[model samples]
Target: MRILGVDPGSRITGYGVIELADTKPRYVASGCIRTRNDALEQRLAQIYAGLSELIGQHRPEVVAVERVFMSKNADSALKLGQARGAAIVCVANHGLAMEEYAPRQIKQAVTGQGGADKIQVQHMVTAVLGLNATPQEDAADALAAALTYAYSRSGLVAAGSVSSKRKSSSWRHFTP
Candidate 1:
């Protein structure tokens, strides 16, 4: 399974791709798309187009996006919402499964603590993924989002399989 993770921002939208096989996930690629602040519409268009291209290139099976958190600046939040909406629409239109995680959840998944700071998150991302350094901070966040999805789903699948095997074993014992 290939998961695409996005960290949406008006000025810089970060994205990462990870592929999972045999229950292990590995980072594939990651980067951020930047847009000029002078024109909102243009920036949105750039993000939309760039995202479309990326989708075509990577062909990710799922998309994981970071949910909006409480922001002090209303305008910033609104703009971010727009960018996020673009990503959501792109994923939905493509008939791809989308998952969203909160900032705290992503941080906790990456760092093992919900309140881990940016530096801590960045460091962990680099250390775990063997990323030479943190890819830009936002990019690091995006990678973490992708990894979080991979980790969560991997656990669920393993647990389900284990439960299924146990049920089958108990059923055989009772049948005899």
Candidate 2:
């Protein structure tokens, strides 16, 4: 199955695409949709349009999005929520099944620790996907979200074997 994972932000929304073949996740593409410092409505429209175009191009079987986490700054959180909502609406409009995963859940799935930092997540994602170089921060986060969905669907997360399974250089070698 092809999965599209999203890490939404008001200024820049990241997206990654991966395909699961025989329970192994293969990287397809990843990038960010950066919006100009414009009106809030304009930014939201840009996000929706960008995601819609990406969905059409990729035609993923499912979409996984990171849920908005509470922030100390209410305004920041509200903006993130709006961005996330735009992403969700884009996925829904594409008629694809959508799954929401928390930030901690995504980190745990990728790095075997809920509190893993961005660098750790990036390293793990690169190792699991066998990328030549590390992806950008937001792109790596998006890829982590995709990896989370892949692991969850394969029951590795539920079995509590992500740490062991991720030791492999590639998901192709992941037994679970």
Candidate 3:
């Protein structure tokens, strides 16, 4: 199954694509969606548009987004929330299934610890996907999100909800 993971931000939104097959993950793509320094709404619009284009291009089976991590700055937090909402709206409009995972959950899945730092996450992401180099901070975070979902999904496959090819029997409500 192809999975698109999103790491949303006000100035830059990162995206990663991975194809999971036979308990192994193949890296497809990863990059940051940089938004112009403009008004908040315009930046949010850019995020939505860029993510919409990515979904159209990649056509992922599922989109996993990192949940909001409350920042010390309220304004920053609000902007991030807006950015996340914009991205979420774009994916929902594409008629795709979406899942939300906490940032710590993502880090834990990728690095075996919820307190892993950016460098650690990058290293694990590289190792897990067999990349030649560590991905950028945001991109690694996105890939981590995708990897988290794929690992979280293993229980369903064990439970016979998925076939050998990762073909599914259900969409939502199956949590691991």
Q: Clashes in each model (backbone N, CA, C under 3 Å)?
A: 0, 0, 0
- List the candidates ranked by lDDT, beginning with the highest: 2, 3, 1
Ranking by TM-score: 2, 3, 1
TM-score list, all predictions: 0.85, 0.89, 0.87
Q: Give Cα-based local distance difference scores for all models.
A: 0.80, 0.86, 0.85
Number of clashing residue pairs, candidate 2: 0
Task: Give the per-residue lDDT digits (tens) of candidate 2, residues 60-150.
Answer: 9888899899999999999999999889777766767777788988998888889999999999999999999998888899988888888
Per-residue lDDT of model 1, residues 93-124, tens digit only: 66677778888888877787878988987898
Candidate maximizing lDDT = 2
Candidate 1 TM-score versus the reference: 0.85
lDDT of 3 at 72: 94
Per-residue lDDT over 1-176 for candidate 3, one digit per residue giving the tens place of the 0 to 100 score: 99999999999899999998977889999999999999999999999999988998999999889989988999999999999999877876777778788888787777877889999999999988999988999999999888877887865222422222231334222445
Q: Which regions in candidate 1 have their CA more than 4 angstroms from the true location? A: 156-176
lDDT of 2 at 31: 90
Candidate number with greatest TM-score:
2
